[model samples]
Target: MYIAKINIMTKPEILDPQGKAVELGLKNLGISQAQEVRIGKHISLQIDAQNEQDAKEMVENACKNLLANLIMETYQYTLTKL
Candidate 1:
């Protein structure tokens, strides 16, 4: 069995309002040194697969079809054995 970890985030050129909000909150709390913060989504899945290739294919498909919005976001993944 393996665990697949996926991260989805907007492109750097795009504005991140949520991240900005968090930065502001941090500043208000006296962490004024905080420069910038980017927020993204994290997803994890457990799958039974024969090898890393197959597991990677499944993860890529899931990212393209459902896990991410390709129009506005990019995705990266990592697979680990359980």
Candidate 2:
């Protein structure tokens, strides 16, 4: 089996209100050293595939079809044998 770890984030050109809120919260808490906070989703999946290439394709399809919103979000994944 292989494990896939996917990270989905809003496109750089888009504004992230949640991230902005978190950044504001941090500044309010006196953590001013931090800058440019952006929030994202991390997804993990287990695939019963024969090889890494297959696993990658499956993960990519999932990302394209269901996991990420392609219009505003981008996704990246890493597949590891488990």
Candidate 3:
């Protein structure tokens, strides 16, 4: 078995309203030190595969096909044996 940890975020050029809102809220709460805050999604999946390469391919496919929006978002993942 393997585990995949995926992180998906909006492209750098894309506007992130939710991230802006969170930054504003942080500032309102006196967290002025926080700067350029961004929001993203983290996903973990348990996969049964023959090897690391296969598990990685499956995770990448999932990210490209369903998890991240290629037009506005990007993704990265880490795979580990479970």
Candidate 4:
């Protein structure tokens, strides 16, 4: 079995309104040190595969085809064998 951990984030050039809102909220709560609070999604799933390479390919395809928007967002993942 393999476990996939994926992180999806908006492209650096894209504006993150949600992140900005969080940043503002934090500052209002007296957290002035927080800056550029970029929000992202983290996904974890388990896959049954013959090997690491197959699992990796499946995860990559999922990220490219469904999990992330190529134009505005980017994603990266890590796989661990169990």
* Candidates 2 and 3 compared by lDDT, better number: 2
| Predicted structure 2: clash tally | 0
Per-residue C-alpha lDDT of model 2 across residues 1-82, encoded as one tens digit per residue? 9999999999999999999999999999999888889999999889999989988889989999999999999998888999
TM-scores for the candidates: 0.95, 0.96, 0.96, 0.96
For model 3, the stretches where C-alpha displacement exceeds 4 angstroms are none
In the range 1-82, model 4's lDDT, one tens digit per residue, is 9999999999999999999999999999999899989999999999999999999999999999999999999998899998
Candidate 3 per-residue C-alpha lDDT over 36-76 given as tens digits, one digit per residue, 9 for 90 to 100: 78899999989999999999889989999999999999999
Q: Which stretches of candidate 4 lie over 4 Å from their true place?
A: none
* Candidate 2 TM-score to native: 0.96
Alpha-carbon lDDT, every model: 0.93, 0.94, 0.93, 0.95
What number of clashing residue pairs does each candidate have, in the order they appear?
0, 0, 0, 0
- What global local distance difference test value does model 1 have? 0.93
For candidate 1, write residues 1-82 as lDDT tens digits. 8999999999999999999999999999999898769999999999799998899889999999998999899999999998
Query: Of the pair 1 and 4, which is ahead by TM-score?
Result: 4
